[model samples]
Target: MGPVANVHADTLLIVGDSLSAAHGIEREAGWVALLRERVGDAHEVVNASISGDTTSGGAARLPDLLERHSPDIVLLELGGNDGLRGLSPQQMKLNLRTMIEKSQAADARVLLLGIEIPPNYGAAYTDAFRGVFRQLSEEYAVPLVPFILDGVALQDDMMQEDGIHPNAAAQPTILDNVWEKLGPMLSRDTDRNE
Candidate 1:
């Protein structure tokens, strides 16, 4: 993709799946919106997340989103759908890498938000899935939120009836997870406003 001349350092764009899309919850209740409130009125937060979106889909659609948002920071919260579909972690990593590269090419810093699938996927597969984000983050030299679910994942109260997506109560905690890794990565220009 060709480079775009405009990059909004105060703009935060999220390219992700259901979790970031607020699958079964209110859009205002999602972590991305909460983060906007936390970051204050200075930064523009754009949510490009879609339910059931795989990394491949994210990779494919990111170029346009990058150009449209001109984001300075891109938060990638995908791969759970890929793992659930039993897709290869190696290939998922490739897709994630492609998205990160595209974002970086557009002069936006990327933050990889990691996730893990159910144990039913088998230990080896699950472990490998987890490792993909770590490897990509280290290789790309980007900040990573190891697991966005954190303390909320398996808890019945924290999740929906499907036991996959987190409920509204878990959103604030989710925002904390993102903020931990994402806060330090915000540009110096936005840092002052935040």
Candidate 2:
């Protein structure tokens, strides 16, 4: 429900693209906002997601975000835009790795959000792009949201007109996907702290 009694809140910084930024939907109707409501006083979500952000852009900006928020959890949701732009998966992996390394170095636990582009991007390319998150997560020992838009992305009605972003109705589903993994981390950490 709301805040879990007297649990001290953890600052969560979200660095991503349109999915996390609430591109075509009202800001309050986005998943990030819903996450704030879900966690209530148990967590603080600092959304730094931009509509067209890429892995490189996120890597470059991460140092600043890490310094600014000093978040206990850093949600990494980039790479979708990079895939859409046909960027090199190697470079994308490097960028993602950099961000993960940097955030971990800053003492913030990272939660990499795995994203998959449409199959039209070709099996090889799309697969590699999707693999980067898994590789990075394993290398860094970070928790990951397997697919941030899992249930939302496939449904036509769940997506926006552009079919790229999720509709307002899908925000809750998105939150549920993230919460599956994230909630446990928060709960365990909160338990240890208390």
User: What lDDT is reached at residue 14 by model 1?
Assistant: 92
State which candidate has the highest TM-score: 2
Q: Number of backbone collisions per candidate, in order?
A: 0, 0
Against the true structure, candidate 2 reaches a TM-score of 0.94
For model 1, how does the per-residue alpha-carbon lDDT over 39-137 read when each residue is reduced to its tens digit?
875578999999999999999999999989899889999999999999999999999999999999999989999998899989999999999999998
What is each predicted model's overall lDDT from 0 to 1? 0.90, 0.89
My TM-score estimates for the predictions, one after another, are 0.92, 0.94
Q: Which stretches of candidate 2 lie over 4 Å from their true place?
A: 1-7
* Per-residue C-alpha lDDT of model 2 across residues 1-194, encoded as one tens digit per residue: 77455545689999999999999889999999999988887778899999999999999999989988889999999988998999999999999888888988898888989998999989999888888888888888888887888988879989988888899999999999998889888889878897
